[model samples]
Target chain A: MGEENVMSDDILVIAEHDGSNVVDVTFEMLSAARELAKDSGGKVLAAMAGGAALAGSLGAFDRVYLIDDPAVSNYSPEAFEKAFTHVVRDVDPGLVLTSTSTMGLDLAGGLSVAWPAPLVSYVVGLGREGDDVVATSQIYGGKLLAEVVVDSPHAICALIAGSFSGQPSPEAGSPDVETVSLEGIGPSRTSALAVHEPDSGGVDITAADILVSVGRGIGSKENLEIIEELAEALGAPLAASRPVTDQGWLSKPHQVGKSGKKVKPRAYLAFGISGAPEHLEGMRDSELIIACNTDPDAPIFDVAHYGTTVDLFDLVPELTECIQA
Target chain B: MVLLKQLPDLVEELEPSPDGTDIDREFIKFILNEFDDQALEEALVTKESSGAEVIVVALDEPEVDQVLYTALAKGADRAVKLTGVPAGTWVPTHLRAAILAPFVRELAPDLVLTGVQSAEDLDGQLASLLGGYLDLPHAAVVVGLEVKDSIARVVQELGSGRSVEEQITLPAVLGIQAASQAPRYAPISKIRQAMQAGGLEELEAPAPVDSADIAIAQVRIRRLYAPEKSTHAEMLTGDPGEVATRIAEILRSKGLVKA
Candidate 1:
């Protein structure tokens, strides 16, 4: 029954981009799509609006459907939905994948209705099980893994950030780029009035190779100096969980979590940080994770390579001194 | 109006059932979803300013009355409890949307507010799916909102803390991430007063249309298990000085710091 319902051996990934460059999660989705397509005997195809020139660099894609209309220069859900729906109808892909970013969620939500396909968001893993695609995701805030069978032949799913490592294409082969035009689409109900960019002086933690991240356990704003010194001693950037940033001790850019910067640094030193799923979603991919918290049962320990249960007040200063010495 | 859900509190320890399909709920404690609380607060705030009647709607569940009374204490004018679906049934978002769309239509609400995503969301989408089902303009992850002159101006949180301001005409859905202000605390006296007022209205949920498409598209939870810990923390136990020295050594060994 599943084989008879198969539409085509094509995995469509909706690529996301800022006006200038392709967002990193788009490649991550492509990587996941590539992995899933291997078992399904499907070709990985990427659908992107704007940033068409970058398509050539994405050699993993079998084909790139670029919608380069000025209307879509900025993300309007209606334009994106119309363009994506057109591509979905034209390609008739077996599976569609996108990042779980805000724009990705908007598009996938719209397409779920437009394509009338079943959507599974926050997908952490995808696999083929006896002709049915199984999507694994976290529910109840990452407490349990829910393995859902995509009953629809053409299933839509969104991949969470940092869930898959986005490796570049092994070999550079220029993918066939098809420029699609979306014209005469009506205006959407909502219109973007303005974008408020974070201050330019803010730290870009995503680009940092090493991060010393603090959480609510740091106690107060005055204690941040010790963590800052430790970060300086280690020659790494200082990052924080949502609580620290929310408390105004650190800037928003310094936050490491789902709603913040998703960093895959070489080393992550977490102090007083309990591993909420949101925080883990950002920095879990680090090569080495060292966490310190007063609570031994803090979930951060689950992903940490090394852990020390102690007050940050006692440990951080001593740790900074040791690192400096 | 605000849509609320009673969720198993996250702080509670959970274990998968013997069948490995879902968490064993017998020992769990249910609490109102935090985001939904914020949505309810947003509605109450709007009511404070615009005199709009705030109605709180929730699926029938254990401790749902507590949530509704809490909303009532927080200034919702009406509370609704939808019946027919048994507690703990994992109704997919689309089915929930199908069930609520008609009810919301009946209310003819100028604005509908829901949490952007629930902590227990299997699909991580309810507001968007509901918007699609209702064919209403919707925005997600909104941090701030103001309803004025039939136009809703919303501040939406984008990736990396960037935000965009957008205007959507009223009779739209908004998936609220945070309210403009912190949710007001309802005192014990107020909550008790609300419970005594006895204004909770129960409504029979419309039976979901039996569609083959929806049946086939429904998500099935095959297994539920604790995520296997790929890497275990090697606990370093000692005085602060000893632990710090050990951490320094480990950092040096990993080439994160110079020896």
Candidate 2:
């Protein structure tokens, strides 16, 4: 369980890879880690779980650990748990940080169970606490913010994807790369199939610059044609709350919310959405939000930049015609 | 069958910060999450098919008894309030599993069910974390379930638009999705019976685990504010061509169209 060079208090950030590429959240977590490392006088280490040549691509960290094994070919909770458990033991980091992605949540949950230390997920803000680190997390579906103090010598937390916008790296970008072997550590159960990306290419809404969204108030499937035109006119992709996707007017890939993709687009034009708590959870990070709905009292209007009480069916067509002109 | 914790009244009016940051209350009211209602619905269906006695349970203030009463009104054969657990404290999924384990083990239900995540906590870690603590087969975001013999086949939603079917031996934990099944409303007659039955057992609270290792370190308010309002669309009251010109201009300014 002991490694010769493991640092007991180094902050470990488990990097996330989209099978072939490292997700942007990796850098976001690194940015958060840089702050913690500075305060605690600890080093920030990036752990690449899987994928091709990613360990070399991430150059911002002081140390990079590549846990590449034939067994960890895909996103399996068991595989990640084994690899992360090894990393924690090997590195002996005081704090373990990861991006709160689908894989991250699963891995973090497993770590909490495997280790006696405290684990936090979906962290939006972080700072150092004398020797420990404090994190601000959005709980209760973005309705409230909780300040958590992770005092464990071995504390683990997952950073939310757009919590802190990425910052420029001032240090010369050369990091030491260490390839770790997963000889004995392996997943109990495997994915049993190839990893496939959908047609939308798993576009992250949180990172998009512009968004066009449809909601339940958008009315009927025929009405979707108007929003599609709007998206087409703007050259922006189409997104919707859960109801639109459930109706099959839009594919599940286009759904945005706590249950869907969390988007932080520069501009998000939401049409006909009721702004339910779960629906709002995903888009809480968008920079500019616009709501067009019949109900002036819609919860979405409470947080929107521009609000209209006119029926979307009437407004959408009129708006579409105006945009086309 | 699965247990869903009933929620206390929602305090939607509380906007502590004009910017929508920080909660004024030390603890918000408790209530069962909406998705958990769907889990209860799925359990009710399983009970109907197999004639199994489904027991719904919760750990909260007596205010939640009305929710359990509502569950019974919907068709749960039995409902009980789990005592011993403190209200308003952040209960990790593993701790909850530990508390529920002995009781669940004693009852020995064929399957365990709960809402995929709690509404109030929004941790979304319970079902999976509980499964780990129990060391049993578990699935999250289960969209479909079919039980035959002692085996349960479930359709689970993974990331992206993909889904997979997995079969588990009896006694599994499933974190249900809100879209998985439609939650049925409780009939008025059953609601009355559940409220009148009044013999719900309250269990003792489990020991509090020290969160010092995982305590809240510090909180930062990163631009907390209510969602902003969208700009009013300048209505184009003219023919299609004229409207199109205005639309194009707007789209162009928005960088959505060629100028």
lDDT of 1 by residue, A142-227 (tens): 76778888766678888877788896664868888989887666667777778776552557888877899999888788878988
What local lDDT does model 2 show for residue A256?
89
User: Can you give the lDDT of residue B11 in candidate 1?
Assistant: 68
| Candidate 2 chain A least-lDDT 10 residues | A189-198
Mind giving the per-residue lDDT tens digits that candidate 1 earns over B1-259? 8888888876678788888877787878999887787788889889988889999999898789989998999889999999987567566666777788888988989999988877656764777777766778787777788889899888876766677788888798888877766677999999999999999999998765343235335567888877887767999999999999999998887788853
The local distance difference test score of each candidate is 0.80, 0.65
* Per-prediction tally of clashes: 0, 37
What's model 2's TM-score? Answer: 0.74
lDDT of 2 by residue, A97-187 (tens): 8754555655665566666456666677787656546777766544455566555566677776666776435454756888888887733
Worst 10 residues of 1 chain A by lDDT: A71-80
TM-score of each: 0.87, 0.74
